[model samples]
Target chain A: MRWFNFVLLLFVTLVLQLGVGRLFGVGPQRVMPDLLLLLAVVLAFRGPADQALIACWILGLVKDLSSQAPLGSYAFAFGLLAWAIVRLREMFYGEHPITLIVLTFLCSFLAEIFVLFICSLKKVMEVESYTSFSLVIMFSAMLTAGLAPYGQWLILKLHRQLGLPRRRIYGR
Target chain B: MAGRRSERLSHKQIFTYLMMGAVVCMLLPVRVTNHLDHVLSVLVAPFSKGSQDMSLMVTDKIHQDDSGEVPSDTPEEPVDATIQDTNRLVNIEQELKYYKDLTDRLSGLRQNQSLDRARLIVAYITGSDSSNQREVKFLDRGTRNQVESGQIVIGWPKQIYKDNILNDEETDAIYEQALSGAVVGRISDAGSWTSSLQLISDPGMAMKVAIEPAPQRREDWRVKGILKGKGLGQISVHLIPATVPVKTGDVVLARSDDEGLPMDMIIGYISSCRRTEKNPVEWQILVQPAVDLQNLREVVVIKR
Candidate 1:
């Protein structure tokens, strides 16, 4: 049942990343929502850190292969995010919607920065001006944060339907 | 405890899984990967096509509404006849001039030792995708039309209608001259219905280029550069030194030294240029291609 939820989440994450995410223009800076990061955050809040880590690795690999970016960049960023979210779980409660939104925003922002950093390091992309980078990050964070409540709600519904407990849902 | 034993099994299982995965990665076939990429591109194409169709439909509707204002039913016979007669006279004069020019050009071709015999095939660009890298695919006049690989394809020249009126004769002349450009690259691969034009923009594409001496009053008039494509709608002309007075507006044309034939075919103007201190022998020159690459729906493939 846990495995099924993970697979379903992966499918939904990819669909949203490619479909609805693309529908929303990336803006002049060409920054779009990091749906995979959002999924990782939501999973980290409700499931075990280990499962979130695995999901991140798998999804990141898929993203790397699908996109024009170098491999393993997304996986590293996502794994770190999953670990951080799990460690912070004791300090924050997941029941609050605003908390979820903020967490999603922070994680997504970090993921984007990490990707940009990786690309630069790989010499695949030149670094944009600091001002442009900041604007893209701010806008992308706000957009992803705004959409987090719906993402959380979907995850919660799926968790319930699958008869999976909020705690101990993902094995450590 | 039972937990410890289960944990040990899990570790062993993971190890086995990782080993299997590594082996699979090493053994994966290139053809399988290419097929997967093709399938993914096909899946994504519909989304882009739908957006394109929507935009086109809106534009078409606006055009139809605008055209509705014109009185289409009005019978302007006398005006039409006058226009027709004028066009006929122009056509006769142009034909006589064309033959005379052709004769001169033919003689010049022989004297200049250039290849003059050629055939043309019209083609349409159906779709483009960058899976392995940026690639453009085209659907050309089929095998029945004798279209083959290594033939140069060029955009159909804009039809210059006589006074915004397109008579059949003028239209034919425009179509005939559609494939007059220099051969940059050729059909690398061919099929029964479609042939792949390995464009001059391909990374593997290589072609010889000749530079014309700069106009008088320019001290650095050494006019020779090789135009190489950097892929993704970017091209660079090499062998031009910083000392050469090449400016942004300077035209980079494809020139062949064969006598009797037109020497230079205009490629595009230089958009930006930079001199590399590390490479004093050459300057990196960027050229904005004259071809409207994104909108290339049809082209004429010429064999000479």
Candidate 2:
């Protein structure tokens, strides 16, 4: 039951990140911020690596299907993000809100640059448009970083409700 | 024993994930088919409607504010009898002119003795996805209406008949008015419930056009051309040589092959013209279409 709820939360977060976040234009240049990337990072740092991989795969597929870009682009970028986050899991703890925000900014920047690189290589978009492209990515990253602390608070609350062990710093 | 079980479970999980990814990749291209496109369009229609409603609300509010400031100050006086009488005489003259024009049009229709006759079906456009998928869902004009493919549809402009003449009776009238035109592309693939009307502005559309020199340049009227659409709300008339007497403000119309016509069906006037050096015998002419294709809701399909 707890596992199901976690998966559902991840799914809803991904959808909101793409749909509502896009509609509100809260991200970079009014583009949608990568909520799925943030979720994957959080999960990799705190939850099982296998679950993080699965979440990344599902979220990437959904984003690709909904967006105008060619398929497999988001999937490749997100899969790499999950792997990288998992590799860096030993360096940071999930309890630190500031660390989570900084990690989100860096991951989002890398993911966006990677997407732009792939798009340019495929001749889908011109390299000159990268100025506007970078603006949207930077703004989106800032917005996502701003929301990271709130997301951590919600994660902690959900963890408690699921009867998961609280961090030793926070009493159960 | 426990370690072996855990390893087997991990292998099974990897297989499941791989299978899922493979299935998603296969289905991605398949989802872009016509059926899925139509389904998604229907889903997105409501969002478009909401946006339109918001714009309308803003416009209506502005109109209300403008009306409040400019109240009519003139005291209502009964119209003068002499003025009314003069207006009545002018109205009769206009009616006679209208009836004469209508008679000529009907006579021309009767004289078309071509064996390759085409049929027409009057249909209303219910929905359209830009210039690409324009489906005209008629109000069940019935099978007897002979609404077939390749039929041309033309919208009749509103008729304004003189009130005093003919006791204000509604008579078929023809005046200088812009009418929307469309050709039937295909019938509904599923059922006879609806038919698709290919708009003139459609990318694949091509039609016969004829151009002549303006009346002012009748003495030097050595220029003639053909008009062709370049899609996305633009049209160009080609083949008029640079040395030929073609200029801006010259009238262009869909020339009828039928003889003894007093006036040509005016489509639009040439807005801009440029002489191409590569083709000295042709001038590139841009035309603003007379009929607003975007706002057209209904059109008449004339039998060819």
Candidate 3:
């Protein structure tokens, strides 16, 4: 596992997700992509399962701290998502760009669901306006899916520069 | 065969460890995290400053692109004397008009205590939180600047008056107390060098607002009501006493209660209002914030 490079990538993603993403949103809706989750999903396929789960946990912890959402919610959500994505890839995997796109959409959706479930259970925020909320979630998911491949490529490049061994969903 | 099982067991173990870590994190005292947040804000202050400057530059470029106009910061371009004269005239006109309006808004505050300018701290918005949380934004000012929680945040909208309403006199009378900037939110979490501001658009945020029709009108015509945030740039002023002459397009301004904010700062413009079938005694009014919050980049916090 390219643990050092992976952590570095996650750190950069965390900083961007914190506030820099504000630069990209447009229109009245102000949609911001979930870059941390995007990276976690990409790492799930490209890194060793164990290291990726650890990365997800750290990323989630950072997110929980940065946001007003209840602590442990994102940590649990991200860890569970990483674990589940790894299991899914091991069971049924593809190597094409479509695989990356679909995985991002699915993983993002899963993260949102897991976050909502945990938050609802904890009762920190009331679940309201499903129509608008889901639309925003779907917008973010689609936006993330659209950009996931390039991020994967960029992270792969960083790994290569760091002399880390590359792993894929399936053996060549 | 046992090797795979061992790996699976290790995976489970890691999961358990992560959960326990989260639990430990949650178990930590709130004050500890607040202190940690202060430290983190200080550590990131320099980076946040740089990013904020870059964001302003980027936003300027975007505005230039959308309007197809030459950016004002293009130093290489020849500066026309006529253009400079025109800009000066525009500035003078705006200042004159704003002061004229301020005269009316301050009339409301004249009956009350005057606001202290010494208490104002100009702060740049270092970053903004995404949609995952409430509509809160991070400001560059923090405890290091003696900016603590419960401070009032205000933003100056470029527009002098709310558009689409022809009643400029009545609107000016309602909004004049705030000078130029409208109340944005409170400094909810003040860190060491950075603080998060809960924007007025955040859900469940409630405040008292006064609705007035004309300058120095009778108390019988004035309405005091509660404005609550519904999120996504929507706010509603609720339960106005039915006797008050509340209308769809009336301007809503802060009505000082316990918050001690100046009563004349324009909260928003009421876009629509209706009496609920369930409660005809109350009027529900939808308000559009004076400034388009999506476009707000910088603000000032009032310590008092």
Per-residue lDDT over B1-304 for candidate 3, one digit per residue giving the tens place of the 0 to 100 score: 6555533457557768888877776656545554455455555555655765677567656655456875656552233332223223323333454456567777565443334332556676666664453577777778878888877776755332212212213433223323555677778788777898777777636777777552233233567777777665678787687767776656677654334453346666678888878888988778877656655566666655
Give a tens-digit lDDT track for model 3, residues A57-161.
777776676666556667777887887777777655545778889888987877776665555565545445756666667878888899998988887787775
User: Per-residue alpha-carbon lDDT of model 2 for B1-304, expressed as tens digits?
Assistant: 5555544457338635654663465345522422222332233333433443344345436654445652233221122232223223323333444456667888456443221132334444333331011112222232345554444444321111111111111212211111121122223211133334444443334444555555455543434466555433456776666776667866565433332121234445578988767776668888654444443344444434
Best DockQ goes to which candidate? 3
Off by over 4 Å in 2: A1-3, A26-29, A160-165, A168-172, B1-7, B11-304
Model 3 segments more than 4 A misplaced? A2-4, A117-123, A126-128, A161-164, A169-172, B1-15, B24-35, B65-113, B158-178, B214-220, B258-263, B276-280
Candidate 1 lDDT by residue in tens digits, B12-123:
3543453345335324442233223233333443443344334434543664434565344435435544333433332233345445656788745653322223344555
lDDT at B263, model 3: 32
Highest-scoring model, lDDT: 3
DockQ of each: 0.11, 0.07, 0.42
TM-score for each predicted model, relative to the true structure = 0.49, 0.43, 0.78
In CAPRI terms, model 2 is classed as incorrect
Error of 2 at A67 (Å): 1.3
Local accuracy of candidate 1 as per-residue lDDT tens digits, A1-172: 3677677667655544543343343542234566766777777777655555565556655554444344455565666677677677767866778998888888877776766665555544334244555556677777778879888787777886544465534234
Q: Which ten residues in a row have the lowest lDDT in candidate 1 chain A?
A: A21-30
Clashing pairs in 2: A28-A136, A28-A139, A28-A140, B153-B300, B153-B301, B154-B300, B155-B300
RMSD in order of candidates = 10.5, 12.8, 8.3
Ranking by TM-score: 3, 1, 2
Which one is best on TM-score? 3
Give model 3's docking category. acceptable
